[model samples]
Target: MRILLTGGGTGGHTIPIVAVVQELRRQRKDLKLFWLGDDHPEERAAKENNIPFQKIACGKFRRYFSFWNLIDFFKIPAGIFQSFFLILGFKPHVVFSKGGYVSLPVIIAAWLLRKKIIVHESDAVPGLANRIAARLASKVLLGFNAHSAETLSAKSLRGKYIFTGNPVRREILKGDPVKAREFFHLSKEKPAILVMGGSQGARFINDLISRSLSKLSEYQIIHSTGVNNVSVIARSDCRERQSNLISTENHYRFCSYLDVAKMALAYVACDLVISRAGANTLAEIAARGLPSILIPLPSAASDHQFANAKIFEKRGASIVVEQKDLTSRKLVSLITSLLKNPNQLETMSKKAKNTITKGKYFLIKKLRISIFKIN
Candidate 1:
């Protein structure tokens, strides 16, 4: 069996597709898989995973009219033509899309070729691509339960909308705490806090962390500062400054990225996580039962990250800090308070685990059967 997977422009879209591909490969070693993504980091991730990849040029239709909009408009036809030839030669039995601007043309091409289509929408409000693809796909999968069957068009409802909780990489599902600590040289005695800014890193969060590093030293810290901000952060000497303030011990570590296995370890070793509320991150955090301080990217499409964070906050699994209200003092206070209150942390962790456990496995198995048609 052959399958074509397409989605990109960010790790949020790419990572989940990679997760599904990982599962598909595990189940069917003979199956052939190809990834179609923009000439971006997502394609690099696919290559790192040893998946065959093809880069396509695509653009989004803007909500507002601009000169670039016309150029982007033209790219659509070019993208569709490019996708048509790729699909014609590849002849995938099915095309699975994690909706994004990059997936729009591939999905349209798949529809034209009468290829069986499966799409996963990872947001509370579906993206424009998935919203359109819903009309053409045989199945539309949702990551959340906010949208109802009746809300979809008749065609989409007939095709079936299944809530297949987001697919998380297998390594993340099971990380080794001891190994993670040893690999990162983390102290087992100190509370560990994992701070991240998604794939690109968040400048606001980075700045806050830089200011709060001294206070945060009471707890061991692992911060993924994102590639762009690494030099700035490293040169700023947040680690050195913290060591100076709190006895010269290795209580902090920073990196631009972490591979899946290392990331799994970080998750396993973490007592609390501070991160942007991306769907993929939320799934990973829940999978590991880590309590969180979620600061949603205010600019995320459809304000989806805020919604994602609220879902966890509602269950007392996380605390949501809007960007506008986020400050170094507030963050330090929250972390210090959460860490000191072990019972509160345990309660939040249990609740977080419960909320995610409610549907994760069933949804994963259901998606597997629906896409691969395996009983």
Candidate 2:
């Protein structure tokens, strides 16, 4: 069987698609998988996984009118034409799209070619691209129930809508805590906090962490400062003041990025995670049963990050700290409190695990059955 998957522009959209592709490959070794994405980190991720990739030039339709929108409109036709030829050659039995601006043209082209199309919307409020794709797709998958199916029109509700928890990397499904700690040279004696700001990193989070580096030393730190922000963080004067608190040698480790395997290790090695509440990030955290403090990006499309964070918070799996209220002092205090009280951490962790375990595998399996029609 052949499948073409498309999504990009951010790790949020790209990583989940990768997770699904990995699951499909494991289930059917004979599956021919092709990725259609723009030239972005998603493409790099696909390459790292050894998936065959074809680039399609595509652009988003901005909410506001501009000259660039005109340019984008022109690109859409070109992208569709290019996708048409690619789909003809590949002849995929199905096209799975993790909704993103880059996936728009490929989805449209796939529909026109009569390929069975499936779309997964990661947020409660579907992005513009997914809203458009929903009309043409045979199935529309949702990450959460709160999203209005009516927004996609009545046709989506009759036979297509399915609630699949966001797909997460396979490695995160299990991890060896002792091995993970040893790999990162973390002392099992101290609580570990994993800090990640997504692929590109969050400037606001980085700044707050930098200022509170000294306070963070009370706990072991595994900070993925993002590749672009590494130098800025490494060179910041905060290190000079905080060097004594955290071992200049091992108290804190800063990484530019994490592959699927490393990311799994980090998830297992840490006692707590502080991160932006992107759908994929939250899904992985939930799958691992880790307690986290989520700071949703205020600017996320349609304020979806806040909505996503609330879902976890409501389940008692995580604590949501709004970006506007986030400060170095507040973050430091929250981490310190969580670390000092093992009972609270344990309770939160168990809740997260229980909530996620209830449906994690079922969701993935359901999506697989829907896309491949596997019995």
Candidate 3:
């Protein structure tokens, strides 16, 4: 079976698609996977995973008027033609989109070609690209509660909606806590907190954490500082400055990025997570049953990250800290309070365990049977 997967722009969109692609390959070794996206990190990720990767014309879609929007307007037509010829030559049986601006043209081309199209929305609300694609999709898969009335009212949507919580890498659910503790050189006496700013990193979060380093001395820290900020963190000497505050030697570790194996270990080793509120991150946190404090990116398109964080906060699975309101002192206070209350942590963990469904299998089955017609 030939399947074309498309999405790009950020790790938030690309990572979940990678998880789906991994599951697809596992289920059907004979399947042929092709990925098309604008030149972006996700394209490289797809290539690394052995999927045939293609770069296509794509334009960013914005809600408000901007000078770049005019340039993107022309790119849209170019993208459509680019996608048309590519889809025609590749002859895919189905197209699965993880909904990004890059996926818009691909889905439109697939719709014109009369190929089965399936789309997944990672956030609580559909983005512009997904809203447009939903009309043409054979099935619209949701990453949150399928029964939510908000989703039921998605524009141009028909009767083809299914609730299949965002696809999470199953490997993330298993990790050796002891090995993780050793790997990070963490102390058994202190609670370990995992801090991240998504795959690419968040400068603001890094700075906040750096400023709070002294107050966080009581806890072991495993921080993923994003590749771009690694040098900045090192040059600033946050690690050296904070060393005096830590009770044990080398109580803090900073990683530019965490590969799948390391991420699994970090999840298992950490007592709590402090990170951005991207859907993919939340999905992974939910899968691992980890309690988190989310600082939603205030500028995220349509305030989707804030909305995503709210979902978890409402469920008692996580605490939401708006980026605009976040401060080093506040963060440290929240972290210290949560870490000190094991009973509260246990309750939050149990709530987290029940917050989301781990049913990537349901989505995969639909892709195989309904989209691929492999039944």
lDDT of 3 by residue, 72-174 (tens): 9888789889999999998998899998899999999999999889888888877889878888888878877643327447555757777667777767877
Q: Residue 95 error for model 2, in Å?
A: 0.9
Q: What value does the lDDT take at residue 149 in candidate 1?
A: 42
In TM-score terms, candidate 3 sits at 0.91
- lDDT value for candidate 2? 0.81
Question: For model 2, where is the 10-residue window of minimal lDDT?
Answer: 238-247
lDDT of each: 0.81, 0.81, 0.80
Return the lDDT, model 1, position 142: 81
Q: Which digits, one per residue and each the tens of the lDDT, describe model 1 over residues 65-89?
A: 7889888888888889999999999
Q: What lDDT, from 0 to 1, does candidate 1 have?
A: 0.81
Instruction: List TM-score per model, in order.
Output: 0.91, 0.91, 0.91
Clashing pairs in 1: none
